[model samples]
Target: MTPRSSLAATAAALLILTPTPAQAAPAYPDPQPVTGQQIIHDPTVIRLRTGGYVAYSTGGVIGARLSRDRVHWKDSGNAFAEPPAWWYEYNDTGDPWAPDLSHRDGRYWLYYAVSSWGTNHSAIGVATSPSGLPGTWTDHGKVLTSETTDHWNAIDPAVIRADGRLWMTFGSYWTGIRMVELDASTGKAVQDATVHHLATRPDLPYAVEGPYIVRHGRYYYLFASYDACCSGVDSTYKIRVGRSTSVKGPYADSTGTPMLEGGGDLLLEGHGRFVGTGGQSVFKDRGEDWLAYHYYDAEDDGTPKLGLNRLSWKADGWPVVR
Candidate 1:
């Protein structure tokens, strides 16, 4: 196990992503020396309006890390000051969870969720960063919430503007992956009464969440991580993907089960030695594309740590997590 202490020299290194097959990927973040602890998970990256990159994570403490290069993130210090008080007032404990940052039109919108497991009392919200900084942030309040027993906990917020519409993808435990379009101005579900179910695990014995959707070529690839998370040293996470020609899909895996009806094309699995490695967030680095997420680094006493791996698509247009 490479102790965080052992990562001393590696921390300050100049880490940048260059196009490469996952196999030939470099050891992430060039050799540099820095100091700090990374206490976060399920990070989502957005290329800023000015073209800088800001990463928002599963912030239980309402904070994030900033990096000039994709690697070597420097903790930015309490980005949210503290969890919103209304989170408790409404009894919705999912506050300060996974956050996705983006600059749209002329403002920076931070979309996030609040919830707890085994409960349907969850909500998704957004706060605006007028100037895109820790202070001067404004809460847009809860954008949406789900109390449906079949929907599971409503957290892990990811967003994309596709097909001339703004859509949000999220889920956990029950009901698997769900998607809905948003009203451009309001940033709430379009309520055009359109919703799509992407995947579920009635057979896998665990939950599937952390969905990332993007269109490539003629395919809408739905990428997700499956299994249990938050169980220290004992997690069951793996990356998975499915594809369909339509944005909202009846996505199918290799064997051909529709993602809408609960199916996936396996992209990566936690090999026995790795145990649990999931809670993924995929983004385009300076190069083509890569995935940034937390994994139980076997070399680090199996402790969950940040990891970024460059990925490539197979000839058939499916993703392979190298």
Candidate 2:
């Protein structure tokens, strides 16, 4: 063989063996922008068993909306035409607060809160339906509550199955987020399980609430909303997160600071037309992780509306919503 032919073969071999860098994953705000119906708060989204998507939020009888394509949404009435007769026991306002929706067995569970403002006297209730459609839920009565004598407010209920058990995370205002075990069959707390205290911001307005827990890879992430909400243009709510290896956590932020010590990694904050974005629930659909929440729209006269964003993981495994 000619000397030049030998050199050409060596060059071609090197070109074929040189590694090409893997393309960096897209950083969310997925070019497919999020658009939907207006007028929802503390929204929790779930894909239907048959098809389509549904979101439930805080408002009269727990407001609900529907999405045929998971992009466009329309008002689909509510869970109740009027507040349940029993709702007056904990709240006279007739509106329920942040709701957590989940499916198990052959039923859909919608857990919500009925409580007065600025008080720990609150109750968390659950209703179930075979299909998660508006006006089809049958109220199962109270799942948990707190009295003036208790330290934690029993609001903002989020449910997840982890470590082989159904667990609930709830609380607000007074003492921060708390969790308890749920009986898989009845959707109620386990008869003798302890109520585990999770995250808190006792020194900073004590404003953490709406705890959504999801398992990603090998870690369990707890997402919470922080600071003020419901003030319209003056709202200051934002989302934060922490993680633990165990379902019941000694959770810590990205920096290893304990969540109980006010440790939270910032996830989302107000920007541009979106103000006070918080009250989040995380879910996976079609292999993509999404953060669903409510935001005060500065452009819409500070009206609270639904907000959804794609969530991406960093190289180190922290979750970010863009």
The number of the candidate with the highest TM-score is 2
What would the TM-scores of all predictions be? 0.80, 0.88
Candidate 1 lDDT score relative to the true structure: 0.69
Whole-model Cα lDDT of every candidate shown, in order: 0.69, 0.87
Which candidate has the highest lDDT of all?
A: 2
Clashes of each: 9, 0
Measured by TM-score, how close is model 2 to the native structure?
0.88
Model 2, range 145-207, lDDT digits (tens) per residue?
889998788999999998788899998967799999988888888777788999998484588
**Candidate 2: regions farther than 4 A off:** 1-36
Candidate 2 lDDT for residue 14: 95
User: lDDT by residue for model 1 over 117-169, one digit each (tens)?
Assistant: 56667888887776666665778777777786554556777787888888888
Residue pairs that clash (backbone atoms under 3 angstroms), model 1: 1-299, 12-32, 12-33, 13-31, 13-32, 94-114, 94-115, 95-114, 251-259
Model 2's number of clashes is 0
Instruction: State in Å the error of residue 300, model 1.
Output: 4.0
| Candidate 2: residue 301 Cα off by (Å) | 1.0
